[model samples]
Target: MTIRLIRGAAVAAAMVSGVAACSAPSGGSGGGESAYSVVIGVASEPDTLSPLLGYGKDGNSKIFDGLLARDADLKLRPALAKALPEVGDDGLTYTYTLRDGVEFSDGRPLTASDVVFTYETVLDEKTNNTARSELDAIKAVRADGDDKVAFTLKYPYAPFAGRTVLPIVPEHVAGDQDPNTGSFNTKPIGTGPYVLSAWSRGEKLTFKANPRYWGGAPKVKTVTMAIIEDDDVRATRLRSGDLDGAILPPNLAATYKNDSDESDSGKKTYVAKSYDFRAVTLPTENEVTGDRAIRQALDVAVDRQAMADKILDGAGRPAYGPLPIDDPWFTKDTERGQDLDKAKQILDRAGWKTGVDGVRAKDGQRATFVLRYPSGDKVREDHALAYASDAKKAGIDVKAESATWEVIEPRMKDDAVLAGGGSTGDPDFGLYTLLNSSLAGDGFNNMGRYDNPAVDKALDTGRRNQDEATRRAAYDMVQRELVKDPGYTFLTHIDHVYVLADRWRGLTTQLEPHEHGFASGPGWNIEDWQPKQ
Candidate 1:
């Protein structure tokens, strides 16, 4: 199998319970000479602040420092470590030297022991980190003297360097508590540019700049992330001056693009290319979806190009594979275009003939399946409807249903789901997790029980080999194989959009991962923002 990349410039276009006396607008600092603060509206609240559990974007909590961190250009740079880790002994070992005189927000010196504790804690069975698989390549982690840490891998994994970009918590604060039920998960202390000042559960969180931070205190003295679950409400707040900025959908963000009210406000709109892509996971165990012919037919039947233009409002691109088309590792040959005639032909060849009801039937089974999506998410709901409409053209019956995650989880093994997740770090991060058979029952990584031995081998080759040529060849094979018998119908890779006020300057965006708004998008380097004098 071979993969090909398609380079084309195409242009186009959350939840809450009541009962509490809604908390008053938190007015900590009113506008004045000392008011170097901004209120940011976010759609969802953080499940936890623990980095090990994948709390923040790219394993960054704004209060914690990782060994390596990416700059605005998505280039890996040293953060807690003084420099990039040294890979030695055939790429099996990684040695990192910690920065000198770094101190946690609690005034404790950071050492290699803290780094060891962070990794070892993640490896512990009792920790229950959702992203533990990211660190599974590491066989052992140890501290060398005071300022150095080392990692020994079971195999020579090429993406091991990027995986080391996880946060390193202070051993003195989080080492003794249960990771699942620790106070540190809520009130964390670290060496990042800010400190967690206050947390009003289910409402908002506050952060104050760390004056003693090694990277220098953030220019914006304070940040308040207000939890506003409704998309319209978030945009409304941004317009009402309640928020300095907020992550908005393309449709809503466009409203402020040329508004007269924002002309003199120094308001700016940012549209960032995101690595996140959404897909409909077709479970292989189900009789209807189990057939490779049915999967391929459905893949080509759905019009991803239309989804990007109509559903995304010109803020995304049609996704062919897991990697975004613009990504360096993306394969051009893997590009797939919608062809309804071909889809029908494939189904007919597979003995799926249209019955009197206009639905395809093969042997004793009907080409009918239930597709579920989270009820409140408008984008997913629209996508599900569009998919069902397209699948109908190929004589397939798709029932798009709205259900909560609780209901969707139990039925993932049997029903199809509209799912989305990916990152800007490495191809292995998304590929290995989504297709690996070992992760099928993990309840998160591999939602659909898609097991292909050939794909597993290709993914293994891509991860274990350090040579670029070998890795690219392996990934290319993996993409082609998936297109031939896909477990998912790739849809659109979204472009994260945000609107910002003119009061603060220097806010630059990077290619964001799946999680948006926090620690990403225009706020990727918010700590470096300066007041526009």
Candidate 2:
């Protein structure tokens, strides 16, 4: 069956009239500089365009510039800000100086008021901000001057600077609107390289390069992101020359690598080891996964090496823990090898006896739980199937189920979820939200309800302390403790895949976060691109 591609006639009309019709060739077969528009075929679509809600998660950073952005090396770099914030009072306070002459896409000048409003709205109880917990430490945010802003924290939050990567919304437009259901989400106006030209929900969204952009207009005048949820379809579109670039799975991406006929195209597949790992979220409240022995047994029972080799097609590495092995905070002792005999012993000691059907039973409760993964995701599905097969060796009945995020979320507390996580430049980004006791029961944080006083203390040390050595030591302790009773069973760190048309040049990449290619993908610096001469 063929998927329908909705025609973006309105966006095309806008381009032809004036805005993006400047000086490029119009034909597609042989493109001129003006005809150098890119259509990206992606696996998922952004839930909203509102920065306050969830647009930032899936590489929508092109439409908005944060106070700070990460460099190629993932180091904090100034975007809207003139430089990094200055800390005082042992990190309790931070002062920022904004870059002069920055303006939103609507031509509204950016000021300290916009900065203050963005933070206040996030902290506001009335607004449903997904990132509310990330900014909870802020006691107050106020403008010191027209071009400056300052923040006072209730306590010294070590990851405060890193969290500043959040996109800054315009106060003039979003100040009075209900942040939860604002029109700005569908039609956003931000201080970024591109402007939202048109949005055809569930189909495609078109962007026009901002002529007045602070960093200057991007090279590709128009960009269209076609939402193709299926992995096979995204790869198919890339091969058919309908898509300029696409994020593909390892197996699909391998098909395009080193293609002699498609020499005009390119493919990149790399293991961004810094902060990409897939794992299963075993809810502690669930009866089947409540026992620490079950959690530990499942961790070792799953052959991580095989998953990395087979599922990822040798494009990834076995992940022993949340932090990648190369990460400075990673501890080697916590990494355990797959041992089926050991897994069975752990279940036996916990009074879980094998039943007639080969499933384990203990105290009238059977070792069975529905393992859910997002439907249409091939990678997550494969991991879920592999996990279920391995768990059977230890008499555990892990029923693999596929459903949308909407369905899986409500049932998360009662079932195991095959979730994708681990991002942000700091360890606190992953550890704090995933394991924090205070964030339990909330959909965004600690969904598994895996609360441990020892784990909490170690995470706090990393968040409360400012010194690098102290923070490093705290994270090391956290890895060591978690290995004993890991909250999530880490599977493998898969390498992100991308196939791009060779018509464009200057496509560089960095160590990507969990979600590939949006914020830090091959076209991240598309503004600096130059058509092949």
Candidate 3:
């Protein structure tokens, strides 16, 4: 929220690390004039550090930046670009004039060519970025000059300008290598405020301030992120003073409430409102989950408010769909509440009769399926368990299990996975890849293999239409269809909670995306941070 204009950041995934040594006071990272550093604990790490492969696709990439960036209010602002883009009246074209003197970490100038290359490569058929569909509206991208880039879209995509937040990669550095397996995947060059210092894979990632950053060098000399996927482990590290800060669940974060009384020795807490949500995939391939009766019944049966109040410790809200209840795009008609009786009626009419064990059965298939969550994620695990409890009341057996993403990926074909996704900007940013039929089972997009022709068409119309009313109607149809045939049982929308060692003056939180604080929370403007006087 307190973005330093001498501006310039995302989180990539990594293995857990012991960074207790980084708990040093201000001069640990740099000496003399640059005597400021901070370390934080994050849950996941990026598979590849390259933007071409989808790292930092949501902006605040830290090491890289998009042509444009968002303010603390989530409004579009100039980053690599000199100003916002000018769109044609038809809404098919967007053109931006690049900021002069913006140089990559390698001291090379950033131009329109780099912007064009970044988009072109990601849109290439051979590239492995699953987020390509997010850019499906782009018909062509052209460099007008050294500082100007123009994009022509197939339709008047209303959210096209916001999509420019896709981080730009140095064409000279990344364009020469294979985007999928290039050396640059681990080592990248960008025009952001920080440059990668060392990547200890499963341990920690270290970064140094870019002295030649266009906005002027950041005051915070170095930043380190310690990957700690387990909630208790992260909380313990923060408690032991082994970390400067960390994102923690509401229950764990509340334990530190008494410590804030003595401000000098304790940390401050922040509650960042977000669109991030937790939902269960009801895969279309599973006999039990694929049934309309099971899907519909489970959708209405789950006590969304119970999960929000009990599991989240009142830090979040019940998620009716991907959008938060307060989101402008949310359809009020799609809101559902606990109705166990109605759920039983839906199942009974569908012939899913209760058998000898109190579990429903239709034909020869039993009403049961395994619910998977990423191992060590307590928030997701709690959500899965709560969902299972709700399913039990309706005569369905939801066996919840925990596993790493490696084990959960293949099983996603038929098994339900506790998943998280949502974005701060346009509805298309959060919905298209999640519900589009063409993207079913492609990496994480549409993991349930949901196929409703009406939803699919509405998604397209919502994405392509220029009229606001038309887009709203299209999205309303999409949400209504999901309620009619729920593909995923949305549990709750999370408001990310973080406890921080308050040693700096500029610390603040932003309206975050699905990535939470890892890429776009309080540290979204880390470059502007200054050591307390």
Candidate 4:
């Protein structure tokens, strides 16, 4: 599931939300204006605010509240629901009791009907949510009176409860308009602590505290996210006093390290370890990338260590596969260290002969291809360039180019893309759509059009099973299969860095996922953010 709109190179964990700007603390959150107002800079923004379209599907969406929300540890807790859902022993049913007296921002009573509507709409075939596949296990959702909701699953999906973080939408407000083009997409009302004040497309999104929020009014009266796409621009704005905080690349964030002492400056640096990974999509449709030997050679050709150090400024760890090496689910046996010699040998054995120019040629076909990264994203650009350099060492020529998603999307079938997407919860959250043969070439799910049936079977096993041993084994099989035939060259799992005004109290970092900006950032609990009184 590409940034959904950002597939944002942000966190797939926080995909449905984000947009930002930059400024210094100025002894006040918003330049000595309002002590509580804060401005943030994010690299991406949500495709739509509507949950039915997949926005806030992973929670942390400030404008909306889910039945459950994640704690700092990424554990699920009650949000709109009174407590955790009651699961039937069969694992095929989940029952949730709606919190009494809860109300949407519009003052409409929160009812079980609303929860039913939200899930049912997303499951509707007419719905355009790319994340629809994630909820495929659900057989039906019914409102048990006005206070309870029950979901019947087709199978016992292990991470289904975590999926309840999908923000509940107000049926009274959104049910009438077309689900895809509804005005609620822009002007949404929810039970969260904030209300969307305005959305200036491609510029910024402004939010104000919801005074009538069920969780109580937020202390931070106003929060504005300036949608600055370029890393350098975001850093420049943060330095110039246009933003209070911004998610910056490692290089940009390093400049602010000595802005003042650790506890002496008006601003502070925050680092969040994440599952977000930067990888090169090897389109099976391309002549150069389609070759199995070429894919295998390039996999080990790119030095993940060098990328972690030089390109990431040591802010990320080299990724051997989709899951971070440190993650519990990652298979230690699947790790592939860089072997430039082995890469060349593999290519040579496959008849990719080095020509006079040192570039590989097979049957008159040159080992040359274009690699596209989203424009304005410095991290991806640097990764693309570094990958090309590494490929060149193996007698492969990679031409790195920059373009917007509009230009890059259509060309994904033939061109390699520096793609960014990751998840924090279940392996199926990220890997399923990424490698499934069925989703090949479906929007940004499988951009390289990778089709591996063995991997697909493994993915299905991992996604459908409820047993921990069974699921773990399935994922292990998936990672192991990638070791032999990787569809994409995964590079690093980044630790997102942010610079924020030190004036706010109770601000902390959580383990983040691929979708970012707002959902996974320190401001994720903006409702709980208190002024430094």
Worst 10 residues of 4 by lDDT: 11-20
Query: Residue-wise lDDT of candidate 3 within 265-320, one digit each (tens)?
Result: 45788889988888898999998888989999999899999998989999999998
Question: What's the C-alpha lDDT at position 374 in model 1?
Answer: 69
Question: Residue 277 deviation, candidate 3, in Å?
Answer: 0.7
Which candidate achieves the best TM-score against the true structure? 4
lDDT of 4: 0.84
lDDT per residue, candidate 1, 235-290, as tens digits?
77677666777888788787765353645244578888987788988888999988
User: CA lDDT of 64 in candidate 2?
Assistant: 84
TM-score of each: 0.92, 0.91, 0.94, 0.95
* Global local distance difference test of model 1: 0.78
Superposed model 4: Cα runs more than 4 Å off: 1-6, 10-33, 258-265
Model 3 compared with the native: what TM-score? 0.94
Q: Please give the lDDT score at residue 66 for candidate 2.
A: 78
lDDT of 3: 0.82
> What's the count of clashing pairs in each model shown?
12, 4, 12, 22
Q: Rank the candidates by TM-score, best first.
A: 4, 3, 1, 2
The digit string of per-residue lDDT tens for model 2 on 384-500 reads: 999999999999999999886668768988888887666657788777777888878665467678888988998888887789998888888888877788888989876777776
Cα TM-score of candidate 1? 0.92
